[model samples]
Target chain A: MQLAVLILEDERPVREALARDLGHFGGHVRIEVAEDVPDAWAVIDELDRDGDRLALVLADHRLPGTSGVDFLVLLLDDPRTVHTRKVLVTGQADQQDTIRAVNDAGLDRYIPKPWNPDELRSVVRDQLTDHVIEHRLDPLPHLQALDAARVMPLLRTRGDR
Target chain B: MPTDVHHPRSTLPRPTHLQLAGLVVGLIAFLVPLLVDIPGLEPAGQRMLAIFLLAIVLWVTEAVPLVATAMLVILLEVLMISDQALVALPEDVLAASDYFAALADPVIVLFLGGFLIADGAAKFDLDRNLAAVMLRPFAGNARRSVLGLMLITAMLSMFVSNTATTATMFAVVIPILAVLPAGPARTGLALAIPVAANVGGIGTPVGSPPNAIALGALEARGEGVSFLGWMLLAVPLMVVVLLFAWWLLTRRYIAPDTPMALDLSSSFDRSPAAIVFYVVAGATVLLWLTEPLHGISSSTVGFVPVVALLATQVMGGDDIKALQWPVLWLVAGGIALGAGIGATGLDTWLLGLVAWEALPLTLLVLLLVAVGLGLSTVISNSATANLLVPLSLSLATGLPIDATAIGVIVALACALAMALPISTPPNAVAYATGEVDTRAMATNGLLVGGFGAVLLATVLPRVWDRLGLL
Candidate 1:
């Protein structure tokens, strides 16, 4: 099954830059971009129709109408995307919003604006690795996108099985 | 690798303190009219008052989506103001559908035309070309660049959405700001666009929603201001305020010795679509200005650009689809509320409560202008105009002062209330750039707003007298 990494940012420049920065994993994963919550749901529906998994979601908290936290809270209810790794990649979300995101959405990470590219890549890699391992999916095919050191044991153990 | 992050489903939507407070206020507003008898108010007027109070509170608190509140206003009008209740409207006064007909008011059509023109301009890069041409004279000077940016932004906002004008100018000025040293000049450059945009929108009826609301209110009262008449009064005020804003922004933030090299010529788009837009937009403006000769109302004239742009294929279906519907709904809601107030005779009752004869006309004008400016700084300017224009007109009926003049002054003052980021979309857009914060915006806005109010009070009366409106 194809793995999807969704970038939900309303701003086109920020969305394009985020997608471009994660281009290395595009070969093995579906790198989808959505401008808002409704667009994100359409992408999720398309992935579900194709029997693909939404492995991660990097969202901005301040969107046009429905906020990123509200969308994250929504994902918890969907059976298809309940396990998706959620990250808040914005500088605008206040403490209350961040707390709600963590408490309600099971947020995996918080990356403030003007982020380090290395840190962003590492976060994506680690999240993907965790998703693969938790679901007991074979990590060998998507090794390029994962933390190899952490997934190596899983691959080795599954190889013997 | 397997970080066990437990994802729990919370189906219950959490209501914040503000939302809960809004609900409480909304409930009280809805129930009060039914429970208690307001003095000098008919049953229908009392019911209309309840809906008005509820809508105002809900709009201010943002209890729900703004469009939702607008829809609710229409729904409540149908339910409570029906022929049976006769709470706001007399029996057989209006058909059920007539209550919602405010959505299709001619003034709303004017705004739709404005949006289409703006969208077509943006789609064809016509705005950039126009800005570049306009700024050419002011190039090479640091202070003039600030003035030029403000001038271009303000002028564009006079015919387009203030937010769109600010966004377009923000993109154009960013590169210029980047080249400047990281200091007050950069902040000044960032802050000037929004300030000018806010001031500039006072130039015409279609410049902002508040202007349209004022125009719509005036038209409903059978005392409409002509397109040329409005421009004659407002454009000069806009120019004066814009110049003051430019001075205030530059003197406070920009250094005199700051070097500048603005190259806007390269940003111009000389495409066929742009050419078509220019011809159509120019013709529409000319027609609007010479309305007395043509005998066509300005709102009727607005349809020309809408048809011309579509016929020329300058604006596509997607552009039409992307029109700011919520803003239109918001304006429609204001119009509907104004109609409801008029029908219910709530305007008369409210006027009776205010002692217009007790205060001098000049003091009353200043007080009304101050109230409009103050309320707008805290809420949406459109909302401020919606709340104030109708009341000011009603209040004018009791006094010797002219209602049309009061409407004009109140509308202009609404546009001038830029004391905070939440005051207007343009201010919020500038604040989002991070180059200028709320503190910087408020400081500059207070000074500009103060100057604008004084200028209006001193100059508007003379202009009104000249136009034979006083």
Candidate 2:
């Protein structure tokens, strides 16, 4: 099964940019974009139907309704995305919202607006690697998108049959 | 915070087309021998033949997991041809416990010790630390660095499982791999780990499952090779094949002038617990090598570590629980299959079908080696050894060759089948790095395996004889 990365954003230009920057990972992972909370849930449902894991959620803090912090908090209650890595990719999240995201939503990383494309990709890679290692998933299928050196310990346990 | 929706889905794997086909084909193969009367085979022999045929299909297609197929072989023998057979055997029947005993065979115990020690090495970070320390001397140039990497990998593989060795070595080299320009040099470095690991597996009985399978079968037939004896018989070939592969890979892919630097930083675990583990692991190896010096069997010496590690709390129940039981069971299944073949007169029936003595010994040996090397190239190496070692040993009974030589040769041949990513776990790991493609792996693997095959089939036996090892 492929690992799914959901991009929760409201702006068309930003959504497209995020998806394009992650284009290389498309072949290795399932990348989905949503305009709001409802659309994001639809993406989760589609992923669930296809038996793909919701591995990471890159969400903008400011959305039309049910803000990204709220959505991140909701993920903890949903068994499907409970283990999903949460990231706030926004410039507008204040101290209060960011605090809640860290304490309650279990945010993994915060990528500020005007982020470097290389750093964005590296953060995604690191987050994805963390997800796989935490879940003890077989990293061979997603080795290209992963930090290869980080997954070697898992590989060592698979003895010769 | 709001409570969210819970969608708990069950994801059970569906059988592939090959598995579906295997089940159907295996049923037909299993029944044919039981229903159709052979010209000279006995009723019990036919029953054993049915199990063997089913095992071949299931193992090849992997209709079930490899360990499942192994466990199935043991259960089938108990219910079909053992003393508790569903249809009472008209001839002498092996006791059911005889089949079950494969799980705890002396060879299995030996592997159990080896595995615990290997696991402990990883737990204490001893493997990576040791590699770092050993690789310091060979770090100047690309060629020398690769030689150091390969030699260290092979040395670890001689004691650790081959797959584990490759993984450990890859963990050490991946940073270095990233620094080197991604091209033939990267491919060469990636390929070196598996080649060394696969060849090194032949160095010791506990190094790989196929070795345990061969040793188990040979031990049952009253022709057991001491641990040191096994080293003497196989290590020379292991060293030769490794050097040949190093030369081939360097000449073809690695340029001597390429920029390379190996990371040698390491911090070994010096905890009291780590000290206890080192002592136990070291004493175990010393005991295995000095088997001739002392009267204790390798398996008995193997058990000492299992007891000492636990008694001293160096390794506990959790450590034992983490041991590779599936591999142990798979080897056991092969032992049971081998035992059934001999006990039910199936070997006699098989020997009569082939005029093996008529073929020149060298030609026959080459054929056996070729078949072992070829079959295992696609299937699991342990399964290939499981199916071939017993039959070849039985065939040797009627020929003018040492059974030990035949058994050891077949096992080593199985180790040499690494021409594809699917051939062995170590190869699969190298391929997953995406640094080495199939063509490079196949070309290098073929040259290495072929070179090893020729030496194993033609030269190793004579070497054994000349050294009075056989």
Best by TM-score: 2
Off by over 4 Å in 1: A1-161, B1-15, B84-92, B267-271, B467-470
lDDT for predicted candidate 2 compared with the true structure: 0.93
How accurate locally is residue B37 in candidate 1, as Cα lDDT from 0 to 100? 88
Model 2, A1-161: lDDT tens digits are 99989999999999999999999998888899999999999999999888899999999999998999999998988889889999999999999999999999999999999888999999999999999998889998898889988988887778896
How far in Å is the alpha carbon of B221 misplaced in model 1?
1.0
Estimated TM-score per prediction?
Answer: 0.74, 0.97
Candidate 1 per-residue lDDT, tens place, B386-453, comes to 77888888888888877788889999998899888788876765665556878888888999998989
**What residue runs in model 2 are displaced by over 4 Å at the alpha carbon?**
B1-10
lDDT (10s digit) by residue, model 2, range B186-229:
99989999999999999998889999999999999999999999
Candidate 2 DockQ, CA atoms: 0.65
Clash total of candidate 2:
0
Residues A1-161 of candidate 1: C-alpha lDDT, one tens digit per residue: 77889999999999999998888888878899999999999999999777678999999999999999999998877778888999999999999999999998899999999888888988998899899988877664575576544543342121000
lDDT, model 1, position B367: 89
Q: What is the lDDT of residue B266 in candidate 2?
A: 95
